[model samples]
Target: MRCAPSAGAALVLCAATAGLLSAQGSPAQPEPPRFASSDEVNLLAHGLLQLGHGLREHVEHTRGRLGSLERRLDACGAACAQASGTAAPPPAANPVVGDAAAPETLRNLQVQLKAQDTRIEQLFEKVAQQQRNLEKQQLKIENLQSQVRLLAPSHVEHKVIKPARGKRLPKVAQDGDTAHNASRLHRLPRHCQELFEEGERQSGLFQIQPQGSPPFLVNCEMASDGGWTVIQRRQDGSVDFNQPWEAYKAGFGDPQGEFWLGLEKVHSITGNHGGRLSVQLQDWEGNNESLQFPVHLGGEDTAYSLQLTAPVASKLGATAITPNGLSLPFSTWDQDHDLRGDKNCAKTLSGGWWFGTCSHSNLNGQYFHSIPRQRQQRKKGIFWKTWRGRYYPLQATTILIRPAVDASAS
Candidate 1:
């Protein structure tokens, strides 16, 4: 019963030591220990002192029991000798005196107890030494952390470079833009239609994440019916649309001005099979024309091929050409995926498109402010054949896309 508390205390101390060792030996440094303060160390030391006091009290109590047992035995023996003359001995004292092996067993127990006490004292000393080592390591860590804090500003200064006055700065992601992009991406609408559904009416640049893809900027054109995600816009020809395959794939342009909103982004926004495409074309005389059709745009694996069904709506009265750009993979000067064998439609027409036999529509063609003089140069301008043959370059063009289901419902 006396050894029970001591055994429990020993187990507690062993577990604490093991935990401390494992923490210190860890490969990855953990956050600063909570017990690094002087007050915590003092509290631990006080606990150890109390344990020592308890062990000393236990030892004294054991010694007192041994002394009391010897005195009782002496009294019992005297009582037994004078049993006939005096009275009979006490029943409790008689057992201690009559039992021959009791004294030897008690002595053996006393010896074992002394050995256990010595071992406990040794363990206490080891624990104290470990405590001291831990304190020193904590102090060193605190100093290192302080030094790092002091030197961080200097390291940052060394890494930053200031551009000279009147010198054009190199292109890099500005901190403000990066921060803005991050904030915009955190809560993004799936598409422009979603913004329209949520009661947004203004047309402007917006950030969107299609499906589960990374967020990117897009221009949302709002109409009376719904919002439209503008994929390509050719206005003043500030941006060249005749770029090679890579440029078209990654997209090149500004959302505020003329820009092509990349093929990959278009494919993602269009979803599984395809979506609806809305085209707005204006001739040099300001004769505006609009058309909508159900179109399926393939991915880069298919060279972003175009497959359009019959036009759902058209503002360009009746025309001879049908504007059918069906099942023709997109073509560029570098990578020709067009249907023509001898001539690259993109190279010949000086624009990129899903050119089947180099006809139909080339909305991504070269932009002209007005009518061109040369007859041969006329074919290179932005023109939709169904509205105004292939030679009359259109003044402006805007291409927008949305889901086919949404278009049908609208």
Candidate 2:
């Protein structure tokens, strides 16, 4: 991926001496910040918010300048028009001029007037170009602000859950090993597991292929299990589904290779509610792909009835996709998460890490999740293909999708 230049690059456009002083002041002051495990998420959320504020302020400044230039141009046009209206009163009969001399002087005056008109046109053109550039930059700044809000916990909700049918699943999955193909999903087509796993904690591509068909709708949601800390459920579900859930138009080769439900958990720096992620899919018809290994939210693991319609087979390389999201990659369960008597309250899924469950500071206390330091530097593979060559990194994040009731029937 191409690394973008830092914001400092934008400052160079201002006056050179002012930029130098600003540059000196910046280094002399404290550095912007390098995310810390203790508060990475907050830093990011807050930093973006601050940037949005700054951009809005600059946008206002540019708008004000444009207004001033517009007024001056209008005045210049008026003066030019008034001068033209004064039919040159027969130049006071040049007392010593031959009628030819009068024409020469008038011609010189006309040349000056033409030059002035040309200069005004050039000025207007320059102003118009500036206005367009300012507008483009404003649009970009606003877009970035919207993304900041998306990553903010206060603005995002998680989507989660799925079900199982006939067989029995283990009481709990191994906290340390999720790669063991002995898992049920391994026996299924490879693409099933690949898509789900790729978006784990945010790594996968969801292209919205329409092929003159209905547009598939996707949304994400977050939930708190009655007894499990968001972290514990994330780390210890026997029926885990941390895999990426991908969507392609019908008949995309019936999926490939092998796949499985993968689940993992991560602790918030502040240790609030632990996060849980699961990935499982079903078509409109009746094909049960990963029915053997189910994924879940907070409830008991049971077969979720999902129906597959006529399998949609798309032309070789055509499938529309959208963003499905990702989940955290680390496990959060441990001895510290056990809640003794509080059966009604939610417990931590990841245990005693900074944000897991404990009697004093419960997981349900506040929904704030901390951004572990170094996470920004870690590649989550979570990129959204907003368009070609436009992959927006998922950064350190999570995606949860709740399947429809009928989605489990198959």
Candidate 3:
């Protein structure tokens, strides 16, 4: 097989050929020009020598780098073998011989080295891309931090105002005093004063003592049905029936329309069996009847209520003249019977004033006697029972009364 000469050997062969050609040139060929001085020739030779030295140094550096790379690749191969749980192959023999096969092997090694260099360049590009991505993410984080700083103050402003522990806070009235007074005036139905007077007169007939300071505050109104309803019961030292009387009266009165009278904070005395249960009626007035009948305690829920009907004066009988000169003759249903003219109205045997059915009579067959259940806890608030049997708290400090609507109209 034939082999190509190396670069240095080829250069030497070319120089020798040129010398021979010059010596064998024909006489007709013109002689080439020579340097004018030996110093000029020497200067040119020095330049060539320097260039050759530089080339040699570059070649040597390249060889050293290539050797280092080979060593590193061998080390990496061994490590990969170890990681893979395999024995490394034996090292290949060096191809330093001056033969065609040796040259071919060297060329193959050069091609492998170039391929490794290209793979290394690709890895460097990936690292650069990852670094750029990291920088972009860092910039985004900084921008978000700046936005949060800008919005922090407004968020703090919206924070809720928490009250101090173990301290009671006074309620802030939504409507001012003037507005409240205006609302009261607006809610007052026509002929409210007359209804208030009638309730007071009837209460006196039953010997129902007024409770709380200024016992009577004429702030009630007449309902659409001409029935009187309590609007507010703000008397001191009394249980405030904050609900309007019209709401309770509507449940019993005739659908076609009926008159009702409500008294606020009347007194009641009850004698059950041998035990006596006395409670000051919050907003009811009817009779001063006393009972000696056997009464069960805590067995059943029973209450005493006062039902006053207007336009039923004929059923009530003659008006009883009082010392105060307030003549009010209204029918009153107490316990189970009508005590309009019963002289023993204050003294009874089995019934006096209870919400349950009485053998004597049920007033006009209207069940209008019910006192709200007192809360077991000592909370100073009122709760109303809904039809669904749920109790909801109320902040009723005022009473409101309006005329009852006709049943037909409703």
- Candidate lDDT scores, in order, read 0.67, 0.27, 0.30
Highest TM-score against the true fold, candidate: 1
What's the C-alpha lDDT at position 215 in model 1? 71
Better structure of 1 and 2 per lDDT: 1
**At residue 99, what lDDT does model 3 achieve?**
24
- Identify the candidate with maximal lDDT: 1
Worst 10 residues of 3 by lDDT: 201-210
Better of 1 and 2 by TM-score: 1
Superpose all Cα atoms of candidate 3 onto the true structure and report the RMSD in Å to 1 decimal. 36.6
What are the TM-scores, per candidate, against the unseen true structure?
Answer: 0.51, 0.24, 0.17
Q: Please provide the root mean square deviation of candidate 1 (C-alpha atoms, Å).
A: 25.1
Rank list by lDDT = 1, 3, 2
lDDT of 1 by residue, 1-410 (tens): 25435644755775786588567656575665454454554555555555545545654555565557656655655444444343333545534555332444435545665665565556555656655665676576666654443332111122232331111112343655564445343445667787677666767655566775787767788889777999888889899888998998888886657888889999888767578788898887879988787778888888888775434313322223356634668889999987779988999897677777777778898888778899789888887877888789988888999865553243
Model 1 CA deviation exceeding 4 Å by range: 1-187, 310-325, 406-410
Error (Å) of candidate 1 at residue 335 is 0.8
Considering only N, C-alpha and C atoms within 3 Å, which residue pairs clash in candidate 1? none
